[model samples]
Target chain A: MELLCLEMDTVIRARPDPNLLYDERVLQSLLTIEERFLPQCSYFKCVQKDIQPFMRRMVATWMLEVCEEQKCEEEVFPLAMNYLDRFLAVVPTRKCNLQLLGAVCMFLASKLKETRPLTAEKLCIYTDNSIKPQELLEWELVVLGKLKWNLAAVTPNDFIEHIMRKLPLPKEKLALIRKHVQTFIALCATDFNFAMYPPSMIATGSFGAAICGLQLDNGDQSLWGDNLTDLLAKITNTEVDCLKACQEQIERVLVSSLREGRRQQQQQQQEQAGPRSKALDELDQSSTPTDVRDIDL
Target chain B: MCRTMSINLSKRILTALSNGPTRRNLFGPVDREQLQLEYQDSLRKDLEDASRRWGFDFLTETPLEGGDFQWEGISGTKVPALYRSCMVGAVEVLRPRGASGLGSAAAQSGKENIPRTPNRDSLKPQSLEKTPEKTQSNNQSNKLKRKQTNITDFYQAKRRVVATPRKSGQ
Candidate 1:
């Protein structure tokens, strides 16, 4: 058995090929299915027990952090949230199970979207090992059943490239917009307020916000056009007024969240500093002569 | 390669049979989602039975996203049913080994075949000493291709390879 267990180090960990992003047919099909799979009502609006909007926010934020730490592709987190929202819409899940649900959704989403799926062991460790591999596997089946095994629901990231295709920006600015769009999408995933809008609308709003964030010089008359809002709306098949409202909502949420995150960081830093400083003072004041030995000499 | 080709062949057949206005109209006025539901419902038993026999948890693992199975070298097909069934069928037909024994046996067979291919030097008993050196060189080349670069460069490089056809008058 030992002889048979040969170590092969010739494997290549290829970065996911960018060509996958350009599959128009697959992307279009995903878009259609996503529209079909969207929940007709928000989770809060629906009559569900034990699950609330804040619980979703906490779980989503946790999922976002895990995905970022792991350096997963941009699609993984949003797709996981899609699974989470869809499952919550159809099934009544306990608040206690929300984190488990998040983990399983990510496990399933990564398998679908990533070249290497997040393994059960790694996911268990992420949850502080509170959920066992077997339990995660069991719930994986349950979530899949609830989703009716449709895991490729359209995500805002899906629309990023499509929208980028239409936007008239230089390569560098385009890259910035893409980054901003991704951040906006992740931010949307964390807030239940954004769920009411369709994925396409959210994508358009995010794109609009991303462009605004870039503050790209609109001097290129041919590309910038007189009215950016209408162009974005038309591209996504959304109404201009509705697109504006969504974009504003996204900006508002993004601003508040950014402030909130900074505030939390500051508080954390102060709290950490306070405890360490007090410990240092205690150490300085204590005399080293007081020694107690419990051993039987 | 053969595993992938056969999967692709079967998928192509399934899609060519099911796609287009004529086939879509056969189910007349049924919404796409409902039709998909019927398709999965009809195949659930077969899928479950295959899983039970093969001892593979396809029900949980497969994302059921789309049927391309492009990772398996199949494309242009939208039938998850055909792709999965052909995979199970291929596994069953190629290796008659018992379920528990199949994992290692298949792995061993794959490893054994790799050296026996056109790469003849790998098979010579004396060449065993040189194998690690050869694999090391191969690893270096693979690493070169897998170098980490900024996303902007990668995206630009990809865009150059395949200029996305622009929509007219967008």
Candidate 2:
């Protein structure tokens, strides 16, 4: 008898449990405890003397690219960023050690969330071998200490299901909507501006942005503009004005990020094509499909 | 030849530009010595804070004076080996909660190791730190678990007495 075993490489995922998703208490507890995981303050304004917001963006971008390239669990990237933000909020880290911190955060988050957690050696390689595996391991303790070992952070990804289940999304489009929302959550994580916002707010705003961007709202009056904002604000219990502002800010970040990703793509294409071969294919590039990139929320 | 040269040049340019996975260093070269000093310094600070909060000097393995909780000492043998604070004397590092029991697991002979193989180097330093992931130790590896005497394990109804019980019942 012949046996088939071609699918061994696929990640085995548990179906979303009805027990957790269907329970209102689960959502309430998430909302209640989510604030505990938020960074105590915006570190740039107070705690960190050396690290700037742009530097954060840079490290965050690098970290995102690594996670994407590695095909890490979707929550892994945002959770890692949560660790990074929480660590930076309390510790006065120097500029040189920022990447190390980023690596440590990924190490901790991946371990917390993945079945096959990223090994310390591989993470070190992603840092261009700037750090040794031993150093990564060593600083893991330091990062843990700084975080007070609160590794199970309530990330925006945690809120996606509870919020989406309540929204009037079409059943068929759920998969695509989820993908876009997850992408937005990862994007929000990379931007330091969204670091302090509660995970639920980010999740709700991402949902609003996803529905609006896809023009899903045109079908139903409940999902249109102010109505949509009111619905979303009610789902997450966010202030209406605050939710409106958050959703709009999320849209702006998406636009700028797309522009940045486009510019970077063009530059890379031009440089790769070299000066002699072709005219700057500016028009050709924009017509290309939107590739959700390192910063493309 | 010219095309090949352009491709090589572009490849080099991209590598220099830090695109894809060529993996450029973010903040430039780190001072290894300085990093070590800072790591030690931060761990020290963490230890100090933990000591104050828990009212236990993790380094000295003793309770501090005028603290929130009273201190008591127990011989390592009485408790389950997993909770023993000073099972192995050579390693003393600062973890806010001295789950030294875990670090001691690394030092213990193979007869009693946790089912998971912790990296010795990793466990060496965090001798005091709690390994938050050890929750599965209780459910797995019955052979490694050092089975204890539960009442049901040994106390069961007697099957029969050979003498006259069956005949008498009849």
RMSD of each: 21.6, 9.5
Q: Which runs in model 1 stand beyond 4 Å of their true positions?
A: A1-33, A221-226, A272-297, B1-170
User: What's model 1's overall lDDT?
Assistant: 0.63
Task: Residues A54-157, candidate 2: write the lDDT tens digits.
Answer: 89987988887777767789899899999999999988988999999999998889888876677777788888899998898889999999888989999999
In candidate 2, what are the lDDT values of residues B1-170, reduced to their tens digit? 32343233223322332356536688998889999998899889998999999999998789999999998877755666456555333123333333455445434431122244544564655442334334323333363555665556454433344435887978
Per-residue lDDT tens digits for candidate 1, residues B11-34, read 322222221211011111213353
Candidate 2 chain A minimal-lDDT segment of 10 residues: A288-297
Highest TM-score model number: 2
Model 2 clashing residue pairs (backbone): none
Per-prediction interface RMSD in Å: 23.5, 10.8
Measured against the true two-chain complex, the DockQ scores of the candidates, in the order shown, are 0.02, 0.18
Candidate 1: C-alpha RMSD to true structure equals 21.6
Error of 1 at A266 (Å): 2.4
